[model samples]
Target: MNVFRLFEERVAGALGRLADAGDIPAGLAIGRVVVEPPRDPSHGDLATNAAMVLAKDAKTNPRALADKIAADLRGDERVAKVDVAGPGFINLTLAPGVFLDVLRAAVAAGADFGRGGVDGPKVNVEYVSANPTGPMHVGHGRGAVFGDALANLLVFAGRDVTREYYINDAGAQVDVLARSAFLRYREALGEDVEIPEGLYPGDYLKPVGQALLATHGPGLLEQKEEAWLPVVRDFAIDAMMDMIRADLAALDIRHDVFFSERALSRGETDHIAATIADLRARDLVYDGRLPPPKGQAVEDWEDREQTLFRATNFGDDVDRPLLKSDGSYTYFAADIAYHRSKFERGCPEMIDVWGADHGGYVKRMQAAVRAVTEGRGELDVKLCQLVRLLRAGEPVKMSKRAGDFVTLREVVDEVGRDAVRFMMLYRKNDATLDFDLAKVVEQSKDNPVFYVQYAHARCASIFRQASEAFPGEPFGPQALLAADLARLSDEAEVEILRKIAAFPRLVEGSAHAHEPHRLAFYLYDLASSFHHLWNKGKDQPHLRFVNQTERESTLARLALVHAVRCVIAAGLSVLGVTAPDEMR
Candidate 1:
């Protein structure tokens, strides 16, 4: 149950009563009224800006309105006290029974305690569209983890989410990969080969080459470039995709769909051509000459009429070229067609997770989405910043296996998948993250993954101790749910309940914002509060969860512990991290 939402409804009812009583003008807008946790916990359990938001519209003083609202709220059975703070804000302190009810709800809901209430639209999340040139790197891993976690969050929040990856197989990079694999194939045939410049030099292509040699042997060695390029390109891309899939599997990331760029042109539909034709019929595409791009001088810059999309009309800085000087479709053109395909698949809500370098491309892509979907589709692009992998404050330069850069697998192997996933999501997607290998694994409060996992583990340990202390008494969730929770009257114990009760609200907010980091932060805060309570019990034996003398209080406290464990497990599941019963 969402206490904040319940209170918000009550507050709205009070405002309606005021309107009927003629204490305030009729039909004052109350849509913006919000009830949430107070900025300072010491002030009250919840705070609302209803008075401040409606004061001017109702032609009433904010403080006077707040006083009236507070007076009305005090009549609520669930509201223990209500006070006006800072001229207009109304702060509410909930009754003790309310907090007890939250704990019981959490236990009853179990793993689904924090699941969101709103049923949102179907969504398509596209991320980790790394070029099929090699295995994924650290930056790609960040996007993968972030996107996967976001998909999980949306599903938990009651949205139909499709996790997708757009393969860049129809680009120049894949051609280079084909050539590189050919070199490896030649090497497999016992011929020494040197990889030329502008081609991939990583050893990962060696396997693709060996596979081609095993299948075709020396037959392909004599073919012309045109004859072999297509066959070799398809084989090389498939092998590289296998490698990429394995890398993602190492981090527990799986995509529901792997869309191919080549399919846009090769499929029976010819989506790219059809998209251009559709836009041209709508007068959105035309042959036009674009001025030279600003701040860059090109000796070969030519202003010639070419097929262009009316990106400028849709809010882009310039009308973007659809066909290149070579007559092939530009990357932007393919992207527009790809997004149109998503819309055609009935996903009006699309989210693309791109790297920070693509910041300038957001507006144009969004504009294209709007045009193609007839203003019915919405696209939100989340740009993930670079990850600086460090060790004890020193920059980590190279991977153990990947020659030039740190590969995702190597990082996962070195520090583990849990550390990588949690650290990747512990910050805002747009903010650069510093992932220190030495720091994240530390068994201290500074390490959020460890702290949160330990909280779950601590709950398990408490339950085991409770089983021994209460020998023969059932300590499962159902038994705890039947406990007399009124025994949980301590301020610290009630505070923990308050935090646990906020999980549903937190899930709703994070899912609506498309921000998984908020959930990560919330888990950390919950773990911190739980750990503080555990430490408190060290000094005050009465606060200990397993009390030898008081059976009723011990059962109530154990119920609280179970609630904490449930919420942490649910949050960690959204992040694709394990909530260990015991940490090794």
Candidate 2:
């Protein structure tokens, strides 16, 4: 149960009563009314803007309206005190029993404590559409983790989510990959070959060439480039995808679908042609000449007429080209078809996680979605900024294994999967993240993953100690749920409950805003509060969780600890990070 939502409904009811009593005008807009935790916890447990939001509409002074609302809320059994702070903000201090109710609910829910509350159409989260030409790098890893975590969050928030990866196999890059593999194949046949300037120089393709020799023998070596290009390209693309899949597996990222761009052009139905024809029928496509791009030399610029989409009509900066000068469909054209396919598959809610370089592509892609679905489809693009790899605050220039740029697997191997995943999500996707290899793995408060995981481990330690201190006494969820939670009346203990109560609301907000970083921040704050409370026990024996002298109070505190653990586990699971029972 969301306490914030519950209090919001309560405050709405109070406003309705005021309207009925003629204390304010009837039918004032209450949609703007919001109830949230006060910025300063000392002020109260919850605060509402009902009076301030409705004052002008109701033709009443904010303070006067707040007084009336506060008086009405004073009758609620759950609210112990209601006071108007500032001009019209009503702050509420809930009764002790209310906090106990949250604890009980948390225990009963367990891992499902913060699940659900959001209801919407199926969402397609397409991320890490990195070309299958090579292994995924650090930037691609950032997008992969962001997209996977986002999909997890959406699912937890009660939305149908499909994790997708778009493979750009039908592009020039794959052609280059084929030529590179052919050189390796010649080398496998004992011919000394030098990789040309425009070819892929990575040694990852050696195995692909060896496989080609083992499969088709050396017969392909004698064929013309035209005859052998397709066969080798197909084999090389498949091999590269296998390697890419392994890289993603190392980081625990798997996509529900791996869409091939080549399929759009090769299938019986030309999706790209179909998409362009549909847009043409709607007058959204036309032959036009685009002005040369600004702030660039146009020495080789050709202002020839090309098939274009009327993206400007739908909020894009300019009309976009549908096909390149070579008569092949442009990437944007295939992308539009890809998104149209999503709409055709009954997924109108689409989200794409791209690198920061794709920021300019956002508006045009969104405009295409609007044109395709007639504004019924909603596309949200989240661009993940670059991740600067650092070691002791010094720039990390190269990967130990990958030779040049850092590969995702190398980072995962060095710092571990949990540290990489959590640190990648610890910052906003649009913000440049400084991923310090030395700092993230450190067992200190500065390491958020370590601190959060340690909190879970500490909870397990408490339960173990409790089992030992109270022999033959039950300590599971059922026992904890039945504890006298009212015994947890300490201000510090109540503060813990307040944070636990915010979990569902936090999940809902993060899912709606499509921001998984918020969950990371919230988990850190919860861990900080939990760690602070654990430290307090060292100074005061009564605050100790395993109070053997007082079994009743011990059970109550244990219940609180279990609830905190449950919420932390739930949040970490959403982030695709483990909640370890023990640190070691």
Candidate 3:
């Protein structure tokens, strides 16, 4: 159950009563009103700013409005105490039994406890659009994991989410890939070949060469450059994309769509031209000459005339070029068309998870979306910062398969997928992360993934102990729900209950903010509390989960343990990490 949302409705109902009594206006826009845990836990269980936020519109002082709201909330049997704090903030202390009731709800809901109502607005999250030039690097893996977790969080929070990947197969990079594969193809035919500069040097292309040989039977070797380039380029792209998909599957990530950049222009319908023409009709595109970039000698630069988009009018630093001097569409031009296609396909809300180098490109693309969609579109760009791959604090930088950087598959193979996914999202997406190979695999409280997964595993051990403690009698939901939970009055037990109660509210906030790391932090805190309480049971037998003499109390504690497992499993699932039932 969403206890915070429940209280928010109660607050709104109180304001409605005030309106009926002619004390305030009918509706004062309670959209900003929220119920959350107090910053200092000693203050109260729940707090709200409803009175303070609505004071000005209600034509009353915050203190006066807070008193009226407090009077109405104190009438709720759920709220044990309501105290008006500084600046008219209201802190509520819920009844003791209410928390136990929530535990029952969590047990009933199981892994879906904190899940939000479904069929909310559709949101498109596009990420990990790494070029199909090589095996994914650690930096690319970071973006993939971040985007996947963000999409999962959105789905948990009830948004209809679409996971998307953009293929960069239309660029000069693919031509280089074709030439590199041809080198391997010749080598496969027993010719001595050296990978020259400006082409890929990785041995990963060897398999592509073998596949080409098996298909073409040495026929393309006789053709000239023009004929063989297309044949090899398409073949290499398909192979590289297949390899990329397998790498992502190793981390349990799958996109609903993989949009091709080449289809924007090469298909029967040239969408790039249509997008540009649609904007040109609105006077948003024009032929103009751009000033020479700063810091270059004046004679060395040329102010060539080009087709440009009016990005400056929509808040970009300057108008952006849409076409190169060679009359080919620029990369930015193709990106605009790709995003416009998203809008036309009924996804006007878009989120792109890009690398740190793309930071400067965010505003211009956002501006393009506005120009093409006429303000119906909204774009949110979250840049995933560089991942510094380290082995015990030493930089580990080269991969033979990728030729330049350490491959993502190598790290996952070394540490497994759960460690990689958790460490990738353990920090904020925009902040640079140092992924230490040595630390994440440690089975200790210092390792966050291990700590969280162990919490679920520990809960399993408790159930095992209970199964032995209550040999013949059943301890299923019916029996556990019948237990006298009033015996669970320990301070540490109540603290864990507080964390469980705050989960649904946390999911809503993290989803709305598009920040999945918040769930990571919350899970760590919950695990810390659970581990602390588990250690407490070691010294004090009364605080232990199972008691052969106290059957009802043991069942009550099992219900609590099971509820924590439910929440942890649900949180880990949203993060694209596994909650192991046992940690070896």
Candidate 4:
């Protein structure tokens, strides 16, 4: 029932027939050929670039090739008219019946109308891997929503996707967390302790200290610093992970795999060392020294030989260091090991959702993927920019519990998860967003989540009225499939029908481009179209969706409304937003 896909197959068929007739060439590539909506609706219903894309390959003039393609399309029973527009674009206007048939299929599918049928290798999407040291802040929520929505979109579009989270439990931050919790543990044992500079001062550690005291009963207080630090750090990491998981649950995000960085080097597997040895065996590693820093006195720069990866050979701007001057593996070495783990798990395509500060790190990591996977794996990183929280245009204060930044759970609890998720995705990921707390809950067009959800609720209201107008008529999606919808010839109704037919194409495009914002934009536009049609029905009595005197016309309009409802629900499901049945 995908109209665009149908046209693509039809266009390819026309090209094959031309080859069979010896029109130009037989092996003209059609990969570049595409079928999409016409830029100008007045031009036609569907547009294709097959002629322009294939002309040079076939050694034919562009306009002449377009004419031949248009002639072949004119022979299609569904095509009402075919025209060759400027240079080589072929626009085909399908008969009205074709659109109506597509509408029937859409209604019959209900909430599953936009599910696609693509096939590919498994994809691993790692996101929200905030260091397991504290509660999630608002910035982490943005990456969490983006990754979850993208994974949902890929699943809807028929891709095998795996949601993963990388736990950074091996860094200096965890050591600091252990010391910070030690202070709180003393306070829990009735000793006054003041948090010193360079130590965490958040009240969140109080619960961790209480939990530690409950488990060990002050035995750890007598142990030396080195003896208790590891035990306390492990305990604190688990507690923080519990809090982070709870925060993500509020937004309906769950990761399938929680890979730990400590596990990379703690057990029998020192993956970072193993990866470096493999690269060295392949001659991709070397003992090298980078040039002195720019605009610096050469004497001030230390001369040291470091273990380096030949990253520039794979596409990076410069060769990167794998070991620090202290002879320890760098963070980049651990990351390369992590991505290699993904490839070994049978995922060649991987995506990382990182904060905006990591924008400069993307290229080097991608280069390492090439060197480690030996061109067998690829990595794509999406950077989410900072979110500025506002309440009625004024900055909100930090959370007392977190001590510095506001917790993600606080925002979701204030305005509901639906508002937080929808507004986070309402803008592109790389753009800095100004989130207004007071504006998202307003019941108006300015609140896109409310506007879209209200559109679904309005559809429910229309069905209730239709039931009263026609007491014995069945108005479910399946029953509406039998409706004689030809009576929906009005311009406004047809506009809605067109919008519903475009859902599958929109879903496919958004998933392929790894952009979920496109789905949000499409949903808002569809909601506006439905709302406009309903307002028009108020002024034109005959256009009313429920009229006892015109049973046939009423059923036709109701069928259209049902399709609109189904599409909006499908779209909201992808974005993790609720399409409510009632607004008030």
TM-score of each: 0.98, 0.97, 0.97, 0.98
Q: Compared with the true structure, what per-residue lDDT tens digits does model 2 show for residues 123-163?
A: 99999988887778899999999999999999999999989
User: What is the C-alpha lDDT profile of model 3 across 251-310, one tens digit per residue?
Assistant: 999999999999999868999999899889999999998777779888988778889999
lDDT of each: 0.92, 0.92, 0.92, 0.92
Question: C-alpha displacement of 2 in model 4, angstroms?
Answer: 1.3
Question: Please, what's the RMSD in Å of model 1?
Answer: 1.3
Cα deviation of 95 in candidate 4 (Å)?
A: 1.6
| lDDT for predicted candidate 2 compared with the true structure | 0.92
lDDT of 1 by residue, 431-460 (tens): 999999899889989999999999999999
- List the RMSD of every prediction in angstroms: 1.3, 1.5, 1.6, 1.4
What ranges in model 2 sit over 4 Å off?
A: 297-299
Clashes of 2: 0
How good is model 2 by TM-score? 0.97
- Relative to the unseen true structure, what is the C-alpha lDDT of residue 525 in candidate 2, on a scale of 0 to 100? 94
Predicted structure 4: lDDT = 0.92
How many pairs in model 3 have backbone atoms within 3 A of each other, for residues 3 or more apart or on separate chains, i.e. clashes? 0
